[model samples]
Every structure is written in C-alpha cells, then in structure tokens.
Target: MNFKHMTAAAVFAGLIAGCNVMGTPLPDPRLSGRDAEFMALAPQARVNSQFERYLVDYKTNEPVGSIIVDNNAKFLYYVMPGGKAVRYGVATGQDAMAFTGRAYVGGMQEWPRWIPPKDMLERWPHLQPTADAGGLPGGPDNPLGSRALYLYQDGKDTLYRIHGTNEPDKIGQAVSSGCIRMRDIDAIDLYNRVKVGTKVVVL
Candidate 1:
C-alpha cells in the first residue's frame, strides 16, 4: 500500500492500543481454583467486554469508600479516597422489582445460602419445594455465587443483595429478581473492601 495509507492505519491501531480494554472473568492466579467450578457450571456465555472491571476517574459528592449503583448504567462503583472508583459491571433488578435510593450493607456472608424469598416463591411457585426444604446450601451450585452483602434500610431487611453470580454473562443487563449480581471474583474483591454498615446508594 501507499506510505500515507500505512501511516493512517498505524494511527488507528495506536488509538485502539491506548484505550482501556478490560478482559472478562479475570485471569488472576488466585482464581485458578474457581476455574474448575466455572467449568462444572452451566455453559458460559460471553460478557460484553465493556462490562469488565475498571478503575476510572469518578466525580461524586459521596464520600470515600461508599458504594454506588447506577442502575441505568448497570455499573456499581466503589468510591475510593480520591475522586476515583473501582467500577464493576452488574445485573440489576427488573423494572417491577428494582430497588432504588439509599441503603446500608447491614450484613455480609461468604458462600451464602440461597433462600427463595416469599415473593420470589410466589412468582416462581416451583421454588416452593426448595423454600420448603429451607433453601439451597452454599457452594458452587448456589445462585449467590461466592459472597453476599445484604442491603438494609431503617434496620429492616430490604430483601436485596449485592452478591456474586453464577451467570457472569448477565452483567450489564437487567434480569435479576432484585439483587445486584457481579462476577464471582468481583464480588469477592468488593466483599473484602466493604464492611457491614457501608453506605450504598442506588440510582
């Protein structure tokens, strides 16, 4: 090709190389154990590349260490000490059940059990048997994948959670019962950064 054409193509490639492109499902050495679990789970689906975790510049009036869920954007930001945040892709609640406004992380659990709430059982009656059986035990098969941070307001359970998901591909979508779903490793990472009573704002 002509020299001018080659120069233009090189510029375009440089632009792409300079952009922030995150990879999905993480390749952290620590997650090697979970790789086996993932393989055993349902067939994996492709997550939108943009949904991957990122450290970005964020301007917010909220204080440091706060958790903010921008439901419209399908992103949950853990505000850092400065004007920065660690953002993670999330699957939010459907329109009829989405939780908005503010709440606190009232409780946290690792590898939490899956209890089909009464309302959920009402919608999915087949879950009644599981509910009657007193919920599914925590493990690889549980829907609350690796951890859970229970949201609460006014000292009452909001029946919503920010938890790990077995379906990472659902990130950047609206399909959950009401909880915020993150990739398993993302949940674990966020769990470590958060403590009970951390403020959570859903917008």
Candidate 2:
C-alpha cells in the first residue's frame, strides 16, 4: 500500500470508533496559545454522533488536497492522497442564500474578525450597530470561531467563507446566511491541512 493509504488505514479504525461511541463525554482537543485561550472560554456543545469527525472511503475525481462541500449532506470533505477523506459535519447556508460553484482559498486567519455584510445588516437591522462599529473583534464570541478560510473566485472576493462557528450544535443543519460553518476543532484541523489557493467546490 502507498504511504497515504497506509496512514489512512492506521487511523480508520480509531476514527470510526469515534463515530460510534455514545453517551461518553467527548474530550477537549489539545490546543495551545491563542487557540487554548479562546476555546477554554468558548461554549461547549454536544455534537451528535453522526456529525462527529470521521475517516471514510471516498471516491472522487477531484485531485487530492481539494475540498468538497455537500450542503445537502451537511458535510465537508478534505480529499486525501488516497481514496480516503476526513469528513466533518457542517452547517451550511440556507437554500436561497447558499453559494454553489467553485472557488479558491485566497486567505486565512486564526480567530478572524467578522464584519456583517451590508446585505446581512439589511436583513437584520439589529446588526447595524455592529456594522457601524467596524465589525466584531475576533474572540470566543465571534461567529467566525477559531479559524476562517476566505474564498475567492476569478481574483475577486466571493464574499463567502468556510469558517469555524461558536455554535457547534448547529452542525448537520442548513441554517446560515451564506458562509459555511464548522466546529472549532474541525476548523483548526482543516486550516492546518489547507493553504492559500486550495480548491474548493460547493455542491
């Protein structure tokens, strides 16, 4: 077996085991520095078993190191070198607001600041104060959570992001203005693996 598959094989059992275990308290991820500072104060939520992180056989034509977001399935997959993927449950944009098509990761940040777009402020006027204030500062309370991957298309900002969310319980559901939301742990994991210019497909 190739090195990638060999690594996948080594972790497959453990990840699957993680997906099946229930009623047991999930352990906090080992984080350091700023990550530790925020997550320690971030509200903890119980993620359902099926939505928990997992490793599974994945067959796709996309090249290795690509990302695929399946909104209907409420999962985001990072394609591994082998025919395998690490899947993480996500909360996607609502039907009308969902973004579909291809984009590239243009930028990334840890604990990114969130500026409510004009459209979002129009939809919820209560957010006007936040927009006036130049956006919320990055921290535990920020909806962008602990990490964010800014999406761009044709050298222009897509005005969308694949970002971490403070609300972990919202995973496996379709309920967001437009940005794709992931749990902090999953976001940090994905951020570590992806880089600027990474391809992403939303379906």
Candidate 3:
C-alpha cells in the first residue's frame, strides 16, 4: 500500500480504538473481585431465559415502589417509573400452600434466623432444635439465604415473607411453604432496592 493510504488507514483504526475505549470503560477490578467473593458464597444455577432479571414493559396503576408477585408465572416485579419494572424469578408456595392478596413489607432482615413453626417441627422432628432453641442462627447455610422481607397487613404480621433461599435451583418453581423465595444474590439486590413500607401484591 502507498504511504498516504497506510497513514489514513492507521488514523481510521486509531479513531475506532479511541471510540471503543471511551464508550466502554473497563469494570473496576476491585468490584469484580468483591463480586467474585460474594458469588462464591451462593453459587447460582444455570437458569432459563424466562427466569432472568430484565427491564420489561410493565403497565400498572399501582404506585412505583409496589412489588407484584405473579404466583402462577413464578415471577416478581418491582414496579418502576415510566411503565417499566425490574422483574426477577421467584419461587412461590405449592398448590394449596400459597397465600394470596395484598400485604406491605412491614420489616426486613439481613441473614435472618430461621425458626421452624409448630407444624413444621411436628412434620420434621429433627428440626425440633430449631423450635426448642428458639431459632436457627443465620449463616450461609441458613434457609433464609441472605435477606427476608416480612409481610404484614394493617400493621399485623401476616406470617409470610419474601426471602432469599438456599436452594437457588428452585427459583422458578413453586415449592416454598407459603412465602416467596428468591436467589441469594437476587434477594440482596431486591432488599437494597426496596424499603420497609413497600407494597406487595401476591396473586
């Protein structure tokens, strides 16, 4: 190639490189390391595309800050402004075990303790310690994975929760006792986005 042609080609390549560098900044190495460490605690399973979080076209008259749980679809949507929402896969209660209707997030806990209810203890006698000892201490192995959002109606506890689960593979299924279950990482993300008084609609 001629010298002038070579120079022009080099300039074009340089411009393209510059644009790419400016457009896509590299992720912070420190943040990447932290993410790696966090994900190591709860490994995510390979999930289907439908179970992935996405910004979807959601039209709802309910105010922004409202959480909608589509039990049949096994999906949870945190409504946002401008007819959009952040959707996440969730595990709801099985057949007759599900709770329906509206409730508000009365409280939340990070790495909350797990106490087996009377019936649960009766069904699984091995879990008697969890009841007799008050509750199981929160940790990586805790059933409440990373966070728990307690549901309430008219200031009264509803005995239900939207919580993280130790079994990430069950995210898109209906298997919980009566509460909504999310993956550990997704739970943490939702916990950070929502407040104590956020409205929840379980359908």
Best of the candidates, lDDT: 2
Steric collisions counted per model? 0, 0, 0
Q: Which 10 consecutive positions of candidate 3 have the poorest summed lDDT?
A: 22-31
Candidate 2 C-alpha RMSD relative to the actual structure = 7.7
C-alpha RMSD of each candidate structure in angstroms: 3.4, 7.7, 8.1
lDDT of 1 at 137: 81
Relative to the true structure, candidate 1 has a C-alpha RMSD (angstroms) of: 3.4
TM match of model 3 to true structure: 0.80
Which whole-number lDDT from 0 to 100 does residue 191 have in model 1?
Answer: 89
Shift in Å, residue 25, candidate 1: 12
Worst 10 residues of 2 by lDDT: 20-29
Error of 1 at 69 (Å): 0.4
- Tens-digit lDDT track of model 2 for 1-203: 24455677677876767665432223435799999999889867988776777766789999999999999999898998779787888999999999999999999999999999989888899999888899999999999999999999999999999999988889988899889999998899889889999999999
Local error of candidate 2 at 135, Å?
Answer: 0.8
Alpha-carbon lDDT of model 3 = 0.81
For residues 1-203, could you state the per-residue lDDT of candidate 3 as single tens digits? Answer: 24465677797887778554222221212223434554567656866667766777789889998999999999999998988787888999988889899999999998789998776777789998678888977666778877899999999998899998888888889898888998777787788789989999998
Runs in model 2 lying further than 4 Å from the true structure: 1-29
